[model samples]
Target: MIEQEQAAGLNRQQQEYLDVQGYLLLEGVLSPSEAVQYRQQLLALAAQEPGRINPTQHVRWLVNKGADYRKLLLHPAVDPWFRHLLGDDYALSTLTSNVVRPGAPDGRYHTDFQDRVPEPLPEFPLTANSLWLLDEFTPENGGTRLVPGSHRWRRRPPPDLAVHPDEIRIAAPAGSVLLFNGGVWHSSGANTTDRERVCLICFCLRSFMKPQFDFVHYLSDEAYAEATPELKRLYGFTAWPQPVDEPAAPKRRL
Candidate 1:
């Protein structure tokens, strides 16, 4: 059974909603100005890499690209919930952004960690995700769709299950953050509008899991030096250390 600690970052009502629905949308996590700033930054970055700006553009390793990106790693609004769900030792798996352009088709309905885990998914969450809405999400603008309580299914959705009957499209203003369990069934809605939809995805996993990006090696010396203790932990510094073998004696027999 999942722990129901009253001291967790979320209040009882918010916690209950997540437990029953498998996801929660926190409004006003970012101010309107902040959201606009992030949206512009992401678009500018996307422009630099035209090859990636397809129907759905993905900009990866955001933390390495800018100081602003690093701030979201420990954003006050969402940090506590991560600790409550994944524990203090959880590590960031990936910091990336997704931009769904106009005319983009609907994404497949699936769970986040489905590919990594086995059948009969574990009761406890192995990972969690936060979608920082840089643009207002609307039914006509490629908002995300999710099935309530799908996290408890303990199995992956059928390949033929194009759309679940219970699936609902999210509609929210910019600056809202959607937090969900990794096992929840979800997909991105098609963008029928003329404008592009953008969001920053912060996917996190238990410290034991292998992160999507090798942040430890990829993080620059300058960035690492400037990182706070909490940020260092989020970057996987607190994960179990890998064993390093000593060099073998120089070829004495040669």
Candidate 2:
């Protein structure tokens, strides 16, 4: 169990909401100092990233590359929440980050996974998006935009050029880490502020699910060797066989 000091910090119904709606808001979990460091490392990374942007001119698939920024990927809150949802055998996809420069446009509303299943939603869900807000996620700053309960229905709209940027905005504070089920309908909002908005988005999944970012190619053998066994398991090193070797994985401590 989380100690009273820490557990007391989380709202009572937050985890319940995450389980049912595929998302939850965690307030005040990060320190201002942490946010400052995250922004520093990510900005430097974004400057060096060479990949093509998705119409946003920001970096993507930048986990292993941002080694210094990995702390955000392994926060105390994230581990407990992720273990609660995905179980002990799960792996850390990577340390995903992006620097949303000023004038970047609002994004499309859509689920983060492939659209295929029964007419209605599936019995179970897969995929999770853990976003560590390095800046104030304000309506004016282009914080992530999400429909409250769209995850239950599995519905979303494409990036609507017509919709005003403010319509679906969610303003989160600098220390707030937003954990949502991947199927939740949402999009990255536009940054109107002159300064850049940097975010550390860590993708995690059940041990058996295929990862979104290619962890295999992103991590080098040297990094893997230096990483501890737990870190290795988090990076897809220990292959959890098909059909699930165990049920829900073992209970996790800390």
Candidate 3:
């Protein structure tokens, strides 16, 4: 159980929302200026390698792209919530962005790590996903479609439903932060609007799971130097066991 002090950043309502629906929308987590800046940064990066931008597919390792990525990495508002869900020993598994271009195709509904992990997920959360909206998510603009309470399901959702009754189109303004259990079923909607829809997602997991990105090699020395203690730990400078346990008995002379 999360202690009161550990979960202080989340109010009663937010906790209840997460507990019941497996997702929560945090409005105004970023300012308009911040949102614009992030979107511009993402656009610039995409322009450099336009071929790499796939519709509804994630672009990995935003940390390797710009300094602003670090801001989202260590945002205070999310720290406590992550701690509440994943505990202090959690490690950041993935930091990536996705852009749903105008006329992009709809994504298949799925869970993040559920298919990969073993069956019968533990009662407590092993991973949490934090999404930072760089553009307003709307039904016409291709907002994320999520199935409320689907995270608690032990089995995969059937694909028969073109639109499930429980599915909720997350129509939220830019600068919002959407946090959800990694087990929740979700997908990107088709974008009919004229502009692109941009967003960044951070996946944090319990120390045991292998992270999606190899941060140790990806993060530059300068970035590593600038990283906070928590960031350093998450980046895996401290995840390994320092010294191997010594043998109880000394080796016999040959």
Candidate 4:
């Protein structure tokens, strides 16, 4: 758990909202120009992929993409929540961008950690996700749909249900961020507009949880060398034991 002093980034009201509503919208987390730049960069990367589909596209492992993407690993507006929810040693599970094309359909409602953890989810959050909006989010433009207060449900949404009565679509400006507990039931809304909706997903989990990608092993040497200590920690380099062959080096705790 994070010490009270260290978790001072959020105020009592904000904390209460998250604890009760399961999600919080942080507006103006990025400047309008920055959001536009990220959108362009992500789209350019997506365009490079072969056999790309129209409905939706996911550009994964963004930390290796560029310096702009790397800066997001420790964005001041978003990092504190990760520490508050997952404790001081939280590790980033993945940094990926999601593009919902004009014809994209509504996504399935589910929690980020439900598949990994057993049924009857824990009372506390095990994971947290921050959606950095690169374009304005609207109901017609595939804004995220979430069931308020569902994080405390302690179970997954019903598979057969198409939409819950309590579900509400989130609408925010381009530079805003939607931060939520991993247990909240949510889905990407359908995109009916002519333009595509873009957002960078920064997902973090407790240090003990397995990450979606093995960033420590797969990260390029250059990237590792350039990473700051906080980035290294977020990449989970110190959260687990490293493999060794022959005689092991001097033992040390993570």
Predicted model with the maximum TM-score: 4
- Model 1: residues with Cα > 4 Å off, grouped in runs: 1-8, 245-254
Order of candidates by lDDT, top first? 4, 1, 3, 2
Q: List the residue pairs that clash in candidate 1.
A: none
lDDT (CA) per prediction: 0.87, 0.68, 0.79, 0.88
RMSD of 3: 4.9
lDDT pick, better of 1 and 3? 1
Task: Please give each candidate's TM-score.
Answer: 0.92, 0.78, 0.89, 0.93
Candidate 1 residue lDDT tens string, 1-254: 23455554567789889878999899999899999999999999999998877999989999888888888887878887787778778999999999999999989988886586888999988889999999999988999998999999978888778889899999999999999988899988899999999999999988888888888778866678789888888888767464445665442111
- Candidate 3 on 1-254: residue-level lDDT in tens? 54573456667778878877988998999999999988888888777775686765466777776677877875888877777777777888888888899998667787777676666666678789888999999988889888998878855666655677888888999999988887787888889999999999888988777777777667776677788888887876567544435654442110
List of clashing residue pairs for candidate 4:
none
Root-mean-square deviation per candidate: 4.3, 6.5, 4.9, 2.8
- Predicted candidate 2: what Cα RMSD to the true structure? 6.5
Indicate whether candidate 1 or candidate 4 has the larger lDDT: 4
Give residue 170's error in model 1 in angstroms.
0.4
1 against 3, candidate with superior TM-score: 1
Name the weakest run of 10 consecutive residues (lDDT summed) in model 4.
Answer: 1-10
Count of residue pairs whose backbone atoms collide, per candidate: 0, 3, 0, 0
Candidate 4 regions off by >4 Å? Answer: 1-7, 242-246, 249-254
TM-score of model number 3: 0.89
Q: List the residue pairs that clash in candidate 2.
A: 22-181, 92-234, 108-159
Q: Which lDDT tens digits does candidate 2 get at residues 1-254?
A: 44542363444477667767678878787789988887786677666766654435555555556455555555677777776666667776556666677888877776765455334555345667788888988877778887766667754445554464434577788978888876777778888889777777877877786766655556665565567777767777576343445576542221
